[model samples]
Target: MPTAPAAEPVPSVPSPLIRAFPTAPPPDGLPAERESTAPAATGPASPGGDAARTAAPAVEDDADAARRAARAPGRREQRYQETRARIVDAAADLFADRGFDAVSVVEIAKRAGVVEKTVFNHFPMKEGLVFDADPPMREALLDAVRKRPSGESVSAAAGSFVVAAVGLLGAPEAAEGVARMARVIRGSRTLQVREREILGELTDSLAGLIAEETRAWPGQVEPWLAAHAVLGLYASLLELARDRVLAGVTGPELSGELRRQGRRGLALLQFGLAGYAKRR
Candidate 1:
């Protein structure tokens, strides 16, 4: 042979997680060790005649860590909810101090001590932050309807629950939160849409529950009509309460008014009570 070409040396890589630990080669997705000493050894110890060198042990991998974190059953959801709550809390502070339109995602992120991407990841839009309605009302309605005495009508059950809720939530302290919410909704068209969307979702869910009571599927008109009829009363009464809240009503006064009006409407609409409380 006239001439032989020289082999190029491969570049060394660094460890992924640990900086200077003498761990073994990383599994896939993890970075490699920097500056290996194996190349410095002389020709594999001359076929092991001098000594047989052992290979390094396997080490922890970044990919394995990621998999473990993702595999946790409820942890990911819990983290997500915590992040959302943080973003909402931050947005509330900014939106209260400066109007909703005045505050930007960057400002919210800065206040929350999170990145801008995190803010958007929790709330798709600013409106979403305002209308993140984790409604206890929904659960209460469902429970009241389901747990009511066998002869009681759904309307009566739901109406009684509403009155109780007003008493519980209509404390003078609760007015500030409700007023803040009303201000945010009134300030933005998008927030109005979000409010409607959340309301519609609750309506549909209630319809499903009502349908269950009637032993009918979702598409049946009986349950849909019943749910809408009940919700209409709720919506009207709720609007009346909202107006009072915005007008500086609070404490037992607002709650008593709500209970009075809510019950009056419900009492009139009880109609036939689904023949549940019929006289034999």
Candidate 2:
């Protein structure tokens, strides 16, 4: 009789977090006021650098110019995009004033000067109104990847986008709109779900980009791992941003602190986690 040996189960790698879970959390921990402000770092991820740059930013379709710049858009396609823009804009204004749930698709159509069916045709659901930023956001990420520095890792380019995003949020013109929108989203569960769905889509899109960078196939392990890790970091960073706003942080204070922490996080990611547990 032959003796059989027991097989060992493989352990999965642990997911990383900005801070360990069940702890006090980042928002409660960030200093309410930064002592001083430093200039944003220049990198492939930043908006633009002073040095002679090599990467070309992604060229996205401008809402007003897309149809015209599309090299002779068909009448139907042109009109369709234009209508969708109107619906999105009208929905934004109305939703901002009355709140997400209080507004109806019919009212949105009325405000947009279109039929309800047109709204449905473009959006398929009311929650889409809250997600108009998805297209632009996705395009921004794509630009970061496409225009990343020649030697930088794809992950670093992504991290740079987060840094740039914080700076953009710090702008005086954007502060109120951002804070107001944050309040509105916090008030609506449906919009929260839509936002999560968008986040997932973005993760998938980024995964695709990572895979392409390495010439890997869909569902391949490398792209999938990198995508999840970076996107998960992005999720945490964003949640920290939201939490800070709720905690009464405002303006450049919020943006500066976030950008600082964001860059620090990216550095740790780039440097690799060695002896992290043994640290005091």
Candidate that scores best on TM-score: 1
> Tens digit of lDDT per residue, candidate 2, span 1-280?
2111111111111111111111121122222322223333335544555342332222222332454445444554656666776777787778778888889999999988999998898888787666654545576676677776466666666666655554455444544555556766778888788777777887888878777767776557866666666667677776676667667776778768767777677676556522111112
Whole-model alpha-carbon lDDT for candidate 2: 0.60
Clashing pairs in 2: none
Scored against the true structure, residue 103 in model 2 reaches a CA lDDT of 91
Whole-model lDDT, model 1? 0.60
What would the TM-score be for candidate 2 when compared with the true structure? Answer: 0.61
Give residue 27's error in model 2 in angstroms.
42
Task: Show where candidate 2 strays beyond 4 Å.
Answer: 1-86, 217-219, 246-248, 273-280
At residue 219, give the lDDT of candidate 1.
70
Question: Tens digits of per-residue lDDT for model 1 on 164-198?
Answer: 55443356756777667666667877666666676
